[model samples]
Target: MKHLSDEQLVFHHYQVSDDGHSVEAHLAGCEACRARYQALQDVLSAIPVTPVPERSADYGRQVWQRLQPRLDECVVPFWRRLFERPSLPSLPRWWLAPAMTALVLAAFLVGLFWSRSRAQDTLASRLRQELRQELVADFQSALNRSQERSSNALAALEARLANDSKAEARQLVQALHDMLGRARAEDRQMLLAMFRNWEEDNAAAYVTLRQDLEELASLTDKEMRRARSILVELAAQTPPPDPPFRINK
Candidate 1:
């Protein structure tokens, strides 16, 4: 025997099929089919239907009017939708581009500032070095010129002293020659007496000359000592040159 299908039984239960009599007759005659239909009816009847809440007649229209903007918003542009979607790291999709651009720009600015600072430092250091080199060269040149001046002054002083000494010696020789010629022209007896007197005066004069020479020698020694002290002081007062700069690299 062919059993009625579940579709026919459901249709018979709901009275939806055109041929309901045949499924009803099968359910009434066949115990298995009858039991199945009873079980289905019992299960369905056991489930309670929830009652829907009642509202005013304009409620649907009002709700649709309120939600229309949101539904319209749902039809977002493709670009906006793409940006609104989130990806990895829990970051918002909209914030990614601006954040990346800001980060890249910040990094570029930092690198630019650092490079500029380094270049400024290098330029300042070079300027300082050049200034120092120029000062050193100037000081050395001044020192050389000073040494040359001192040498020339010392040479001139020595030459002047030599000329003065020669002039003094020549004057003394001329005066002595005049005195000797006058003595030779005088009488022998008178010359002898004059020589005796001259010897006595010469001895006295020689003693005075010896004392004057000693005093002049002392004065010369003091002058030489004073000049040496002045030279030492000048050398001490001179400033030293700056040390050269060194680079580790």
Candidate 2:
């Protein structure tokens, strides 16, 4: 079984514990906790209670009356004592009208001067504001014009560059076409020269073969047989001819 703490017992004694029933059940079952709780109750009961004194209905008035003599001994301010004394001479009634008129005139003059100064200041401020606004407007107008001019210049430059590029491209294409036409003409001339050389070589080879055949035909039988054996030996010793050269269209 769990024992109750002193704080729990104190809360239970004051009936301030949220789990009052559980504390009570624990105290009933636990002998040590119950004895501690009983000692706490005895100690609290033994402490003396101090009673508050009651005040009468006229207490505030009685306090004021008791302090009146001491308050009276305090020094009065010089300005208040001077006004309270009866020995000072009073001013005459005849001078009051002129004094009042002079005071009113002075106040009116001061007010007029202040009003004029304020008017000048306001006008100066308004002029400054208008000048600033005009300066800003002029600056903005100049800036917009400058930006527009720059934009137009940039556009013109881009257009010029584009035209130049197109012209250059056309020239390059024409140059390439002329170069290809020249190359094809050179190739045709080279092919025609090779064909002419091949025809001349074929004619020479035909003339030599005809001479050899006529000499073989004019020989005796025995000489022909000897010549045929020598030819067979030469044919056997010679390298084979290369294949014909051909060109694709």
Candidate 3:
């Protein structure tokens, strides 16, 4: 009779609980398999189960008492928070759009409000007064750099959205989702509404793409030819996702 391997013995030990017929048959006919199984049993038996110590009732009561005051002070119940919100003024029908537009403009202004201060800083003014003054030009150049950076960011976003890889596309979408999730609730809703418009426009733009391809192909210019060549290269490489909005169930 052939002796079992250590792996076989370990497996046999596991199956022993369920009545291993092969383990019994091998052990009956072979000394080595039985010795291996015994070693497995000894190894397994040495492992220990540790039990958690229980606290006395007095200790648990003290912990609860300590937490109770903190919980009372810090955590208002959901119902209280819901009812405690200041009652908003009854808004006019036209208030929502104007309010959002104002908020966005205000935020934009707040973000860039330091540009004028920086340009007119006492040190900056003194240095510039001694030198040539092209503060307006400096502002224009700064603005141009900002515009370029913004355009580059948008182009990168567009390229990622157009990319073929599902992982990259999902990552791009998830980044937007996470950013919108962290925004203020009212701001988030306005942003979502804005995004819905962009999505609609994108859907419409794809249709316009198919139509414009024929128009683009028919155009008479070297630039138009180059555009068609690039478009054709893109279209040939990857067809858009079927049921484009269906990202998986």
RMSD of each: 45.9, 25.8, 51.3
The candidate 3 region of ten consecutive residues with least summed lDDT is 11-20
**Local distance difference test, candidate 2:** 0.92
Candidate 2 C-alpha lDDT tens digits along 89-116: 5578999999999999999999999999
> Which number leads on TM-score?
1
Task: Work out how many backbone clashes candidate 2 has.
Answer: 0
Model 2 — which ten-residue stretch has the worst lDDT? Answer: 82-91
How does each model score on TM-score?
0.32, 0.30, 0.18
Model 3, span 25-136: residue lDDT tens: 8798887767777878899779885878998869978999999996887776788887896767465789889999999999889777777677669778798786666777
Better of 2 and 3 by TM-score: 2
Steric collisions counted per model? 0, 0, 0
Global lDDT of each candidate: 0.89, 0.92, 0.80
TM-score of 3: 0.18
Query: Which model is ahead, 2 or 3, in terms of lDDT?
Result: 2
Model 3 regions more than 4 Å off: 16-19, 49-249
Candidate numbers, best lDDT first, in rank order = 2, 1, 3
